[model samples]
Target: MTMTNTAPAPTVWATLQANDAPALIDFLVNTFGFIKTAAYADGDQVAHAQLDWPEGGGIMLGSYKPDQEWSRRPGTAGMYVVTADPDALYAKVRAAGADIFRPITDQDYGNREFGVRDPEGNLWSFGHYRGEPHP
Candidate 1:
């Protein structure tokens, strides 16, 4: 006998940062069709927020820290997010105040991806992670 366990595939999620989280969340919701599912807030300050995307997808967002230097800096390393539509998402992100690093292009490694810089200077790279579906 043969058996299989099937589940909806999971995609890569990005842990991003924005100096102005309220504005960032507003831009994401209004422009990219993303919705805030949950958040950790302090009065008017958004400590961390979760924005859900399609395909059982989501991203975790936070504010910039003075001592945290690696993840949220412009010239430093950042997070890569895999989405179904990189071009469309890139456009939405760019229109919502992100700085486009490059046009959406099919990468040599078998992904159509693009990179953009968020308000707090973190680079958000959107692409399709070329791999087998999760079991």
Candidate 2:
């Protein structure tokens, strides 16, 4: 018998709201390497957007709307993204002049990681930790 290994597609997504959704999308794409998969908009307001990380998984975001029932405060979300190359990413982010709150460093758990604040004030942590295998 032969078996094929397959990684599952991401189902759960990290989501946030941005004051300037379009600019935030550009920053994430140019600075963090996120691919802009889709973005829905209404004039100056973005209704929704999907940005996929090159490695795996992705994030969803939209324009800030405090009056909406599902409204989320802009700049209040924090996310952790897994990456294979922290040093290279750190260099790119630094060159882009992003606000890095935590410098790239090796963790006691054997992962290399760094943290930054986006233009919208959201916190993002990137690391090499892939998490423990599922039981």
Best by lDDT: 2
Shift of residue 58 alpha carbon in model 2, Å: 0.3
Q: Estimate each model's TM-score.
A: 0.65, 0.93
Model 2 ranges off by over 4 Å: 1-5
lDDT of 1 by residue, 1-109 (tens): 9996475644666666666777777766676567789889785567779898654577777665657654463234475666887777877777766678877888887
lDDT of each: 0.70, 0.94
- Colliding residue pairs in candidate 1: none
Weakest 10 consecutive residues of candidate 2 by summed lDDT? 4-13
| lDDT (tens digit, per residue) of candidate 2 on 26-52 | 999999999999999997699999999
